[model samples]
Target: MPGISARGLSHEGRRQLAVNLTRVLALHRSILDAYIIEFFTDNLWDTLPCSWQEALDGLNPPQLATMLLGMPGEGEVVRYRSVWPLTLLALKSTACALAFTRTPGFQTASEFLENPSQSSRLTAPFRKHVRPKKQHEIRRLGELVKKLSDFTGCTQVVDVGSGQGHLSRFMALGLGLMVKSIEGDQRLVERAQRLDQELLQALEKEEKRNPQVVQTSPRHSPHHVVRWVDPTALCEELLLPLENPCQGRARLLLTGLHACGDLSVALLRHFSCCPEVVALASVGCCYMKLSDPGGYPLSQWVAGLPGYELPYRLREGACHALEEYAERLQKAGPGLRTHCYRAALETVIRRARPELRRPGVQGIPRVHELKIEEYVQRGLQRVGLDPQLPLNLAALRAHQAQENRVVAFFSLALLLAPLVETLILLDRLLYLQEQGFHAELLPIFSPELSPRNLVLVATKMPLGQALSILETEDS
Candidate 1:
């Protein structure tokens, strides 16, 4: 079957899909828990489908022990473990969602975009320049910024929440676009400025020493410079160049990489309201912090729909895994247990220091090597509880025996995570469409390298130009 084609799909159609997706996610909403509460909680098992319960019920500890930790005698369970009814249920709901929401027809921006620059080696100089993750984002998003520049004939960019300004520097120096970076943190702004100066100086020294440059006309002139600002707020006053026209910069391509929570929404709002802001290529993270304008149903249609109240933690579930569903099952199982460990400690705390009733502990030392009693006691001490608090060793051992069920519980939550995230992204796309902008979501980077990899790329082009770009997809 053909993949989803966002241009070919209508905004109402996307809305309808969002409505359908909410049902699928809500079906198991009761099973989902905040990661902070996932471990040491027991109700997740109740939310499991009856079939899953039956399958699990059929297995005794001796029978189910192999798959949990793969001990020697328990290997037999692995042999007969072909059927995964719970996973099938999750896949079934996902398939239903895939039918409604179109895939935007492309993964990386490079697929639909023309070569970002005439020169083939745009990222070579930046090879050793930044951290591995930052380097990946710098190249990928930099290419998109360059593509937007070439598309709109606007070489002006505003990088919002420009931490340490790694992306901002690339947009200005590598692409030679006029950049205005706004960061809330003053220290990062200073650091970004210092690095920008150092790099520019180093390039100048190299050019003078060689005298005879390899490339004619100097592909990189170092003439371009980045303007940095420390914004006191997230309001439009800081976005002057893009929000309202200023000298020499009429239309601006507003780009932000990993603008957490409300920052991405603010950019989208700016894109819709401000005409001079011609384009947006933004990636958002930290969903937990997004201030719900009204509630879980952020879009008008989703807001009006029945049974559409989204919890913040469930909204957070959407970002569970960016690459593949299988990743959740294979590698994430151990990490999921850390939450369990914390919750288990919380349970112990409640029992011994019932009056104190300290609900949760912020930071605890690692608990892997320590036995359950030692682990619980150490965790108690870290949280300022009585370190010498007593725990029932045998009973605690029995509680630990239920570790497999906890994994099952988390797996169920993980299944719903992507669907929830998609619903959120789709709602944002629909919101943009309502505001009269052409928008689409794209997995613009390698998920393995960066989990929060999908970017919401949109443009405010005229109908003719927009159609031309969509036609290129078929070509």
Candidate 2:
């Protein structure tokens, strides 16, 4: 339960965790570095120590879920049936200790209501056009940004990467914050502007319907700006939008919900370098898109550390939902066979055309219903290969029999994924600390609903009491 908070880990603690992560990730680089499509051809199973293979081999999907992923049956305490090597066991324990906790410190809207039977009131008007997942995200993130605004005494909020302005609209209309939404795409910005008018009309109609209810409403819609954020430099377009009528340079809070790759980095850089931009609350996704030297390892400490390099494969794997996969494994669903089928198809591709290695296979629907031969045929056709190519039935059947092994190996990679994510986020936090700013990585969203749940919060000043109150329901 002891993890990073608003009052963050000490300098030494951050370094130590970084060191532990680098060492562990380096040790298991083979597992994390591998492509699952090469699971068969590259002899990935043999790469694991014989002891690990022995302990893991032949385990059913449900057993692997409970044992490796720590998803135990209700009231069932998980214990190892086979003897695992001490080194392997240590890896699991170390990984669990080093990864940032996905368990949120804050209570969700559904959890906060006095009447547990009632639906969430937090997302009322904001939930209209949004999906359930996006609805949950906008509500939680919007509330936090609102709290951050109050804590920082910032009236102006600039939402970068504000796609269709879901978060921006909620903050402006729902929370009454003076907001400006900046997005790269012109079309999305236009749509957000349209949605803003629609929501305003909806709220006005509600007021008309209920004459007795005196509700405080938003003063205006969020100003929409269409511009790409350059991580390397500050854009006047982003800065010019905030206008403070009262005093000095406009006090601003920069925010992004699931800002992709370098866009999140741009927010951090702006928060650090721009005097007006005093705060940041960013939840970043698509680690694979992060650029080397610029997007990752922003802190000198991590950059200098040996073996801290995270390749694209590892970063992509970090985005997967471990909890969701574990539930699928529990069901022992036939869909789990997809990985094995793809890997088998890879071997076939290589045999047919040696140069074509792991080509993208457009998804074949109803995968669970198809035989390995049928799956491979459809896969070859999708990849522009000969679907009529002769196949060895014996080899195909052999690969199909080892579906559990493929899933188990992929699970092992999934196990170390959080550590990769932790290193990346910690690098951001550490970068902020190096610049003498206060920052914390908070699991602000439900991991099940949104796997990339941790939001990196940084401010020019320490939050103090405001930190504790941010996670609690607003009274």
Candidate 3:
């Protein structure tokens, strides 16, 4: 929850960060490239230098959590008995420095309330049909879009990948922004429309009951549109929906809340190519799903740099919630063994059919309850292998005993996760800057609540004080 305050990155700052990422990523490519599922099959432990293995081999889950992951328990001091390699220590410090700060610079709706006690009910109406995590996301993002639209003098707000319209409704009805919600799924669009009506009715009743208590901000429901936005080409359907009353001269602010894969790319493209779009705020996820030909290396600098390529596995790893996993390690719960259990299953799978490499196994319920041998049998059956295959009890026990080592390695990989996410976001910011637009990346949400917390904000004009204002909670 703690991080450095947000600062806008200069052109030179971004370039240096990119160069630093390229160097660090290459130096630690072995750790990043090694998938946890291939731990036994690939002899992943041996892959680490003997010095690293010695230091990390005996670490308990809680020890790994505090020492390597920087999540110290209350009043717990971490003192190492065995001297760690200087290179390893440096890698930890370097990774932390290169990653973008993910703590929110902005204030939450709860904190912005005049009475601190009323924080719980500030967003009460908007909380219907929404989980706590999503409730937090929509309120923060909607407030941001409202500020951007007001600053840019945008007449409309376009919410791309507007799932179930939680964000669109909040922006339109709660913040009084003219919003257009677009989603690729027809069913989800219909569901959003239903929720919109339900919310409108609820607000009307609340207003009638307590007319003096409720502020009368002119509220409107967001118009829902069903369309798949393609990153390669601009869709007329996307642009034609805006019925701007401002003399057909519609200045727009585009926003996407957790737009997945190339869909986020589409938002960036539309913002760049369309003159109507005056500003953009995008939060992207599912990096593994991004297309190679068009999705990554958005700026020319990264494309030209050697060893800048991020394979699908590495990209997938970037999407993990580092903070959440660190908490799990601190707890040292049963779930920590899942990774080791799955890895052991992989070995059994390979022996059954040497060609079957890392095949997907369906989730086994209450897997931690099952013994290693039982879990392996169930996994084999799930992967269409014979469950009756000869058992290797000794090998399975050996793998189980080394569970701590497996967890330590996984934690190390997670330590580098933020750097990968940082590089991807930096590339987007650089891309916008390369095209002569001003862009800044800020961690707008709590990383624990949302792993993909960094939001890339861009405006055609220079954002001077607005950059800092975006971080400020309204008083």
Candidate 4:
């Protein structure tokens, strides 16, 4: 008989009704037993107290209804009716809680961010024994390749601008696919060949030296199967001529690993229009090569895009103080960090030695007006190195500067570096899609391993299908 009366329940009555409902559920048991069992077993109820059963057994519906109807002065009994399905729900949700555990292989939010190394193993094969940092990058590239294979169904690959042929050999031997490495720089191409031979000899020697070491070596090695091609001719001549040589047997894969500036854009264009070329994967770097739209002729397609403009240098014409500082830092190489620490020491010394703090006595000069040799001589003189030493101070200074500059510039340009390269890569992807190839942006390496980690994957799906896929993502 306990329930909400016709007059509707007061706040107190509502509370009482809820309590009564709970009691009814506990007493009857059969009323909502299945739902209750399900609720208790569900992940949502994992943290619920075991004493919830006792709280639900003492509710009185009739008294709750009377209080709600405001009939304290009247002896007349009011008809009670069932209100909201409180008892049913109370039975269903006694101990409910949502599960937060991740399925295996799926990284949890915290895990991915806090401990990236947990998933670092996924990339280990690509990086093992090569370089500690390069592993993550190789893994990222592997992920991209897998995604490309799934999306396009094209497995054949060609690596343009293939430096050292390490990645080229990787794709051939690791992925079990045919790979042709094309390099424009004769010296690099030759170096890659020589390295390839040396690697093969090393593997042979290792196998002979200790068979166990061979067993531990990765299945794919730089010595493994990979055809090296020297495209001494410009990309334009190579792309068109290479198409004829393939004889339309398999999809011509045009890929470039860190293709600088125009080289990347050329690959995109080649894959777009050339029917014989089936897929294109290019990761572009060095945007300074792309002339402003008005400065040079871009492909008709790229020039037609809305707001399309020729790319320009970040700090046109002149280097800023930060840039100069970075250049000096990079030339210092691995010792750059140490040199920076030393700079702090120098600052302290400068403060202590007031006489040494001349107006123009900064460690390095900002202007190129004086050759680096002259600057070094000036520095050595200040630091008491012989100013007239017969040593080629110019070359030594230049070399030191160059070594330091690599690391210093990298640290300084970290912010803008990825943006410029990413935009160029996206542009190439758009070009590929426009040319009738299905293209996707994939992370080819970890940011730590290499800042330039994006790969644009394009394949000839149907005539317009590739564009549609790209459009869907854009929308």
Residue 332, candidate 1: Cα error in Å is 8.4
For model 3, how many clashes? 0
> Candidate 1: lDDT of 333?
37
Query: Residue 70, candidate 4: how far off, in angstroms?
Result: 60
Q: What is the TM-score of each candidate against the true structure?
A: 0.78, 0.95, 0.95, 0.45
lDDT of 3 by residue, 164-238 (tens): 999999999988888898899999999999999999888888888888857556677999999988888997766
- lDDT of candidate 4 over 299-405, digit per residue (tens): 34434444333234331211112223333332423433333222222333343444543223345544235454555456545554455544454434434343222
The C-alpha stretches of model 4 lying farther than 4 A from their native spots are 1-130, 133-135, 146-155, 201-248, 291-311, 315-423, 462-475
* Candidate 2 global lDDT: 0.85
Worst 10 residues of 2 by lDDT: 110-119
lDDT scores of the candidates, listed in order? 0.61, 0.85, 0.85, 0.42
- Kindly list the per-residue Cα lDDT of model 2 for residues 1-475, writing each as its tens digit: 2233424578778988888889899989999999998999998989988999998999998888888877776777777887889987887777677788887865564643564433264534566777767777887888899999988888699999999998899888888899999999999999998898888888778778887754665367899988988888988878764665486778889999999989999999998988888889999999999998689889999998999999999999999899899889888889999999999999999999999877888989999999899999999999998899999989999999989899989999999999999999989988999999988887878786788999888899987777777666555
Q: How much does candidate 4 score in TM-score?
A: 0.45
